[model samples]
Target: MDFARPLPEYLIKRYQGWRATTYSENKGWYRRLADEGQRPRAMVISCCDSRVHVTAIFGADSGEFFIHRNVANLVPPYEPDGDHHGTSAAVEYAVCSLKVSHVIVLGHSGCGGVQGCYDMCEGKAPELEEKTSFVGRWMDILRPGYEALDTGDDSVRVAELEKRAVLVSLENLWTFPFVREAVEGGTLSLHGLWTHIGEGGLEAFDPASKRFMPV
Candidate 1:
């Protein structure tokens, strides 16, 4: 319990600068959010990758989006086993409590999690195949996606699997009764997004088209 450590000097300086400038400039707005509590209309489920900045990418304000990050941006099927389920818990809170109108699953290129799934599926990473590996078990949610992909062309397969990550999460989100009820009642909507990292390009998945289009 005594393993806490100070943040790096650079990050500390960055936080101080934000507090001095950005936070100072938006003090009223910040205080208002604190007073009223957050009622974000949108919930974004994204990867835990450091490169994927949900707020900065969407230019969202402090209380605009309720975001959850996990390896590969996956949403597993609803299982009421009274066990720990972080992503499901977040989704339940967002949909039931927050009443978020929209849920977005965001994926990105060159995702290490997706790549790790690929390696594990292809028998390249033996450690990930072990049952005790947390990441491997978590990444297993995307194993169906890995199997559905055409692995003949290894170069393009990773990118394809990344898109599937978004798709899979969207599909799994519907399995929740609350989500299904909201969607059927026209109260909630699901969106999928895949970003072309380093290229400044974004693609939105069209369910009807079953393809991603530039946004």
Candidate 2:
């Protein structure tokens, strides 16, 4: 408990500014949301990358999206073995409890997690190959996708792998019984998206073409 400390000076100042401006302007809306509870229409599973702002990209207001962020935006296949499952729990709550209509897996370029995964797979990151490495274990979810990748340049391969991570997550979502039921019952839909961090470009995965099309 002693490890916790007060906010940094800069963060404190930023928070105060937000409270004075944004909070003041949206006071009524904030109060309404607290009273009514969140009824988000979509659930976004995105990377832990600081640059991937799901709400900002969609111009969404508070409570408009149920978002879960994790390394490489991964979703492990359904494995109910009584172990702790953060992503699975989030998906269950979003699809079954909140009844969100859409679940979107959002991947982004220049993702450190994806880079780590690629390096680990290529045997260039021994630190991540240790049995005790949490990142390596979590990234094991992307192994199949990496193995299926077409031969190409390093840059192209990494870019394609980033989008492939989104597809992997989407596929895992289907493994969740609740998600599958919801989708098949016409109550929910799944989508995959990838973004270029530097270019501010986005692409949507087109199932028909099995490709990411510019958005």
Candidate 3:
């Protein structure tokens, strides 16, 4: 536990800088949030990549979003076997407790997790096939997405797989009975988003057209 002792020197300096500037500039907002607690309207499920900043993408203020991040922003099929399910737990709290109106699955290009799933499905990653591997087991949730993708060149396949990750997560979100009930009752909505990092372009999935159109 000693290894987990203190903040790094650089991070400590950064914290001081924030307390002096950013936090100071928003001192009233920060105080109000601390007193009122968070009441985010949306829950954004995104990849764990440092580049996928949910707040920055929306220009969101503090406490505007309840965000959850995983390997590929994946949500596994609903299971209530009294097991550990991090994403599902977040979804449940967001829906049943916080009553977030929208749940967005934010996928992105060049997702390392999606690439790993593609590689695993393509038989290029034998080590990932083992059940003991945490990442392997987690990436397995996207196997169905990969299977449902049409075969093509590596680049095309991976890109499609990235989109599929969003689609599959959206589908899985519905498997949570609470989420489905809320959606059916018109109290909640589901959204899929994909970002092209280098191009700085965004695409939104239209369920009706079954296409990802530029946003």
lDDT of 2 at 126: 94
Provide TM-scores for the models. 0.97, 0.98, 0.98
Question: How well is each residue in 1-215 modelled by candidate 2, as lDDT tens digits?
Answer: 99999889999999999999999999999999999999999999999989999998989999999999999999999999999999999999999899999999999999888888889999999999999999999999998888989998988898888989999999999999999999999999999999888898889999999999999
- How well does candidate 2 match the true structure, expressed as C-alpha RMSD? 0.8
Q: Give, for candidate 3, the lowest lDDT window spanning 10 residues.
A: 1-10
| Model 2 stretches astray by more than 4 angstroms | none
> Per-residue alpha-carbon lDDT of model 1 for 1-215, expressed as tens digits?
58988889999999999999999999999999999999998999999999999999989999999999999999999999999999999999999999999999999999999999999999999999999999999999998898898747896999899999999899899899999999999999999999987997899998789999999
What does candidate 1 score on TM?
Answer: 0.97
Candidate 3 TM-score over all chains jointly: 0.98
Give the per-residue lDDT digits (tens) of candidate 3, residues 1-215: 76687778999999999999999999999999999999999999999998887898899998999999999999999999999999999999999999999999999989999999999999999999998989999999999999898867999999999999999999999889999999999999999999988888899999789999999
Ordered by lDDT, highest first, the candidates read 1, 3, 2
Candidate 3 Cα misplacement greater than 4 A, ranges: none
RMSD of each predicted structure: 1.0, 0.8, 0.8
Off by over 4 Å in 1: none
